[model samples]
Target: MTLLQDPANKNRYKVNLVPAANGLNVRTQIPFYSPWRVFFFADNAADLAETMLLYNLNEPCKIENTEWIKPVNYVGIWWEMHLGISTWAMTERHGATTENMKAYIDFAANHGIDAVLAEGWNKGWENWGEKDAFSFTEAYPDFKLKELAEYADEKGVMIIGHHETGGDIELYERQLDSAFALYQSLGIHHVKTGYAGPTPDGEHKHGQFMVNHYNLVMQKAAEYEISLDVHEPVMFSGLCRTYPNLMTGEGVRGMEWNAWSEGNMPSHTCIIPFTRGMAGPIDYTPGIFDIDLSAHKEDREKWNSEDRGNTAVHATLANQLALMVVLYSPMQMAADLIENYEGHEAFSFIENMPATWDESIYLDAEIGEYIVVARRSGTTWYVAAITNEEKRDIAFIANFLNEGKTYIARMLYDSPESHYENNPEDYQILETEAQQLDGFNLKLAPGGGAIIVFEPD
Candidate 1:
């Protein structure tokens, strides 16, 4: 029997490594995110997970009849805040304006992005820290909701509504129907909802009460045909299977942390797939072109001050690119400013990659160390490999590829000089030809990754 099935040692293994220190900020414990993540080789793993999600997963399952929502590859108006350049309100610090949003819409028109997310478009952001501070239906004067939707619709782009409740669940529920109505009237079907703080004092995030709260929101939201992309959310527990409208949620340490905090360790990404990912799709919001923060160093320091650690991505450009495939999100974001990406060669991979996969295989995985995933969409296959703080060598055969068909392998990889802390931006791009029988070797740098796209030759 394998370690997971061998009923020999329960108390010996603590099930999780992240201590209470990691979760004090979120007002929850990390032990709950572990426990049932050790098994994956079995043929009925998903069925086993479904049984667990209903019982020990600690999340309430309120299944309803709803059609599956298609995945979207999107962009947003969020980089300015992460860079510490602007705030969300309408003051001089405000970053999202009509002209700027239109520029984003124009950019989305040409690129493959499906939606443009506008946070702080509503009026209540000034009181974002105050409980019950936001009005769900009201828009800031500068952000013309009517005209903005028209502009996006004309450009063949969709607008993703934003609702930052700031932990006021009561107030959010009060306005839910009307707010969703407003979005529906404007042709907006997807929205990002956030609860940045803990539920009223003395309450925790994953408690049964709060779990039901999330389910109520998803159930109510489905009536208006709106899909929810949640931030500052409870850990995933496979709720998407029952409510397909609950598309993706940001429940882990993500790219934004790299801007303000000590930043997520490279191993954090490798560790999460085995832990929290047992739940569902994560809106980790990957894809940042400026791995080297030189262009925005001043802004980052101004905004973060002493809290900012390295203020740089711990991975090469190719590593960031590989995350698009490795981090599975039906709703993925090209999370960088448009201008920075105009001339970059790696942007094409993000552009061409499909939002959903037909089949996926975990070529290899080791908790907190490294993982490799190969996904197929239509006739092409995409492979991504990533490692933690340590660099490692990897070699795999293409036996998964179809036999007798030659394929062009477009690869984006880390350079020899690439090191997460030393030189995060170093990378090289190449195209090659290979067959099902051929094997390839990859050297993942410290905090680095590799991506390969195979198209029939």
Candidate 2:
């Protein structure tokens, strides 16, 4: 018998979804305008339960045709600081060359990455305080813009255009036409724009100014059929459902500033699940394989007189991996350098990570103390459980799996023998055949974590 399952809400209205050729044919008796939230995941997993809880409001909003809606499956590969594609490159460690740029693009293609966020490749902020930044339509003389876009398109890689303004609203508005024209010429479908500056009139731009601008761009992009990934903007307000093209927005601090500043710690990421992030989807780009906390310490010491505290916690890397499941972003970014993942086994999880989930669950979490998140893409389930600076041993019941099916679970975590100096090969991988009755115990170190990938045998 063909099996079908609908969202189970024993006490209230439920959405009945029938499997269709493309997706789920959804049907719900609830009113169309009923205040509701629909969580999207790539598959079925334990995490889906949590997602339903976090977004499920008091109102009655029913699913119309589940079969019509499919999970989003696009992973965003951020190629700005990591890959030297534009002059706005932050680290200056990498160079901007066609070969180097293509390497990252190829990395994405090889690793099953679906989308590429070419940040800092647009016009503006080329010279931190020196000259104008490079434009997409214009060639860099070293690399041809059109060629790069064509190459990416040919390789089945969707290029996500980026626009970062250092708080220059006038510049953005004035050059809006040219900006759109540039992306259009290059066949870019999605754009990730950001504004980093002092709030106008002493109010946060992300609150009002940036939010208004975000909607404006969304409106304009809708006319052009372009998608949006806003950064340093307003918190999510269920705009994805309304403007399906507005994939995600980044308001919280992400991994980038973490490398230089001390903003994003395990505690900070943990706090987001219930605070600022509670409102909507956060492009709080996760996934940092390399926790080189000692990096730039000399510079920090010589240039400034503050302790450049080490951030490469034993568990933070695992926490990042777990974030792939915890956070809901259509344009998700694995915010780490490619070389950091080279030859590492855990990188497999990062490579296979899906942009959206078919179902997601917040799991157990206590704001800033710790969090457990699970997400499903298909029949397979990916779980990421993480704690803050404090370490703890936890267990997750595998009741979300198919009851009778034998499933294999692969695990990765920080090894007891590994430290900051010898952390490269500290990961241990284990496999176990489990049923719904099995519960997995994970011993995570201080600032450490555990990652599990489950598949039916």
Question: Candidate 2, residues 394-416: lDDT per residue as tens digits?
Answer: 77788888878998888777666
| lDDT scores of the candidates, listed in order | 0.79, 0.61
Number of clashes recorded per candidate: 0, 32
What is candidate 2's local distance difference test score? 0.61
Runs in model 2 deviating more than 4 A are: 1-96, 127-139, 199-208, 293-315, 417-425
Whose lDDT is greatest here?
Answer: 1
Cα TM-score of candidate 2: 0.76
**Total clashes for model 2:** 32
What lDDT score is found at residue 408 in candidate 1? Answer: 99
**lDDT by residue for model 1 (207-298), tens:** 54466678888887888888999998877666676677888999887888876767777898887766667667778887887876677666
